[model samples]
Target: SQKIEQNSEALNIQEGKTATLTCNYTNYSPAYLQWYRQDPGRGPVFLLLIRENEKEKRKERLKVTFDTTLKQSLFHITASQPADSATYLCAPDPNSGYALNFGKGTSLLVTP
Candidate 1:
């Protein structure tokens, strides 16, 4: 079966530092990749997305790199802060009509 999973632990870091998160998978191939940010009890907010054929993608304060060879995705947040703290999710396009299958998620906690 196909599977996807994120850190599933809180990543605590100091403000102004680069925060790195990871997503791993197994048993299936995805068509595209997406990243989302979620605060406690809130639905995920779309961040960045990269297709399987793409190398890397970025937004103002975010970057996402996908390596199909490794079947992994990396997420980065620069200039972090407590306000930036939230759970990050990695979603791969399941190739089904809906096009999304999300990993559990990784929590980010940036200290002042």
Candidate 2:
């Protein structure tokens, strides 16, 4: 009984601004959490992976924080550009090397 919720509405922002997105879940005994970016009509590409024991992780222009206590994960993109516009997904990995069950991603739209 796991639930993941991201902004179903597209996030519209001006270029060069940071965009923050939230992912919330419940009833999942997760061992790890991961973030992915997906362009329209394309498969999701993994961005960050954080174990349940981890507090934060970062890669390039993206940052992710996982709080098992809150059963939530926050994804951030800094100095974002129009090229950054895409859907972002968060899925949990229960430490079994099993595939993460993903929710509908949050769409981001950056305006130049």
Candidate 3:
């Protein structure tokens, strides 16, 4: 079975600093990777999507990079703030037309 691995440990960073999170996968090669942010009581919110052909993508203070050779993706939040704290989930779509596989997610805590 395909599997996604995210840091189970909570990532702590100071406000105004960059926070980098990682997502790794095995047993599958996806055409696209999706990133989501989830708060405590709310469902995940779409953040960004990076295609396999694309090496990097950015939106505002967020950036994502996909490395097909490494079978890994990195999500980055620049100049992060306390409000940016949340659980980030990564979904790798194997171009199955209905990609629904998501990892347990990594928790990020931005401190003042």
Candidate topping TM-score = 3
lDDT of each: 0.89, 0.87, 0.95
Stretches of candidate 3 exceeding 4 Å from the true structure: 97-99
lDDT against true structure, model 1:
0.89
User: What ranking emerges by lDDT with the best candidate at the front?
Assistant: 3, 1, 2
CA RMSD of each candidate after superposition: 1.2, 1.4, 0.9
Question: Could you arrange the candidates by TM-score from highest to lowest?
Answer: 3, 1, 2
Alpha-carbon TM-score of each model against the true structure: 0.93, 0.92, 0.97
The number of clashing residue pairs in each candidate reads 0, 0, 0
Report the lDDT tens digits of candidate 1 across residue range 1-112. Answer: 8899899777999999999999998875887889999999889999988998888888988889999899999999999878999999998878667747889999999999
- Which regions of candidate 2 deviate over 4 angstroms? 95-99
Tens digit of per-residue lDDT, candidate 2, span 1-112: 6688888888999999999999988877788888888987888998889888879888899989999888889999999999999999999874466666887889999999
Model 1: residues >4 Å from true position, as ranges? none
lDDT of 3 by residue, 1-60 (tens): 889999999999999999999999998788899999999999999999999999999999
Q: TM-score of predicted model 2?
A: 0.92
